[model samples]
Target: MPVRILDSRDHVLRRKTIPMVKILWKNQDVESATWELESVMRKAYPHLLLPIERLIPFSGFCW
Candidate 1:
């Protein structure tokens, strides 16, 4: 599971753009953080994103 979100960015595919977040995993270092699709992460781990959404008012997340 992820410990926290370190950063975020947009991943542009051939005809679409997807929001991605750099996730810091439990028992891992900064260098080990991996970028994952925000939508998928939200579906898989809604609880993890709740605190971050509450902290950042304008994080650009719909929910």
Candidate 2:
């Protein structure tokens, strides 16, 4: 199962969690990289993972 970066129990404050992994490119652009990452995740581990933004919706979501 793909790990959910957002809701995982961690050392940091709950509000500070950001599940999306940021990838940096040689061109210093990330717009496409983000999408690529999301795509690979969907194909490889669709059942175990979900986009963090889809769950949180707004800026603040509490558990």
Instruction: Return the TM-score for each candidate structure.
Output: 0.74, 0.27
Return model 2's CA RMSD, one decimal.
13.4
Off by over 4 Å in 2: 7-36, 50-63
Model 1: per-residue Cα lDDT over 1-63, one tens digit each: 899889989999999999999999999999999999999999999877776548777756596
Cand. 1 TM to true fold: 0.74
Candidates in order: C-alpha RMSD to true structure: 6.1, 13.4
For candidate 2, the clash count comes to 0
Query: Which candidate achieves the best TM-score against the true structure?
Result: 1
Instruction: List, in order, the clash count of every candidate structure.
Output: 0, 0
lDDT of 2: 0.44
lDDT of each: 0.89, 0.44
